[model samples]
Target: MGMTEKQLKSSNKPDKEMPLVQYENVTKKFGDVEVLKGLDLEIKQGEKVALIGPSGSGKTTIIRMLMTLEKPSGGVISLNGEPLWHKKIGDKLVPADEKHLRKLRSDIGMVFQHFNLFPHMTILRNVTEAPIHVLGLSKEEANERAVDMLNKVGLGDKLDAYPEQLSGGQKQRVAIARAVVMHPKVMLFDEVTSALDPELVGEVLQVIRDLAKETDMAMILVTHEMDFARDIADRVVFLHNGQIEEEGHPEDIFETPESERLQGFLSRFLNT
Candidate 1:
């Protein structure tokens, strides 16, 4: 069966009318260069959003902030309407401490461009470890969940293989399964296919597309693949110079971009 036929099921149904993620005037800077400038974006529960732009456009930084891998220099980010980087201290909001951050981070999962798996662990172990330790699942429970996820990613037969043994696409699918098995409220994909070979990229993308279809978790993908963006996203955001340049339904953003900058940006991908 194809990757699309592999089912990654979720029990939580999303409340689409409510916002799941909010970036309120968020900003990020690395010394002299500001990577994000007063960025404001919201993602509703169960929505799939794609961020597309050139390098250094801050697309990755946005999701990195959401993943808590990078902290913003200004403004607030909220998960489920609660401040992500801040904690409620009596009547005032204070920068979140480790306790504050950890609680919220549990609700988020991120898959990076590189497959950051445990090289020595088998594929099943890599996928099961997090849920077992973090979520406090029994070894038996974690194994069952891991097996189901591995099957869903077309890696069931490769469960005993180590990361070094699997191909790039298969490793990425394992990474995806690892994240999804956590049952996070939000899933972030940061250029997941960028490190894959051209021939292998399709398999990883197909796994992601399958998960996107099955999960109720809000998904934010920072990618350069135009057709993948068109295929998997409900909304496409075009970023330029650390800000959202244009965003709308994929049809509008891909087929009828109003901004010259976006048109030029898409042309490079669409033309060749």
Candidate 2:
């Protein structure tokens, strides 16, 4: 892991820069069930990755941890080389406060599978609300940014529409627009397209592909779309039973997976 410019600038020490995101010896448990087992991962800036595996294999868990919606039971995580849970105060690693957590989360955006939009707010409001409330942008400034993002997602004309008024694909796009308007450095998608109708999946994937090509923001997507993972991900990780069974370039994971577990998993999905 390496340090980002933002982290470096915040530190007085020249040698303390850290990786964009790092999980070292991380573990998560739910009573008797261990969801992650001493997992270690390092994602540099601008990497596009897809996580795939069988059901209950901890793909979504990984994404949630990155979003800090779930804390690790053990180990440490860092973003941009700075500790997300531990901050350096006079050379001491002290526990982080809620204020720091909120700031840390501002750099990460998440798109849930359910498209969690405000039904009462119009499409524009749904996208603009966070920027106004969380980022402290003025209403007009937030609206302008929201409209531009909506236009980017090809929903310019639907600003006045409600989430219920739009199709499944449209709602997902608006959800995406809401996520990106904050200009997050890392976007975590937890099966963003899984809930959509078969026909609506393509539109969401196309927008994602466009974003992948146009931005330097890193993306970690948990998806069941095998073909999209094969084609769009710079790297693909396959998890099984709370561990990463295989990880490599898309072609390597798809055409030449190194693990029997991955081979079996893909065979079922590919042949389905």
Number of the top-ranking candidate, with TM-score as the measure: 1
The candidate that wins on lDDT is: 1
lDDT of 1 by residue, 85-190 (tens): 9988897889999888999999999998998989989999998998999999999999999999999999999989999988999999999999999999999999
- Which pairs clash in the backbone of model 1? none
Off by over 4 Å in 1: 1-16
CA lDDT of each prediction against the hidden true structure: 0.89, 0.86
lDDT of 2: 0.86
TM-score of every model versus the real structure: 0.93, 0.91
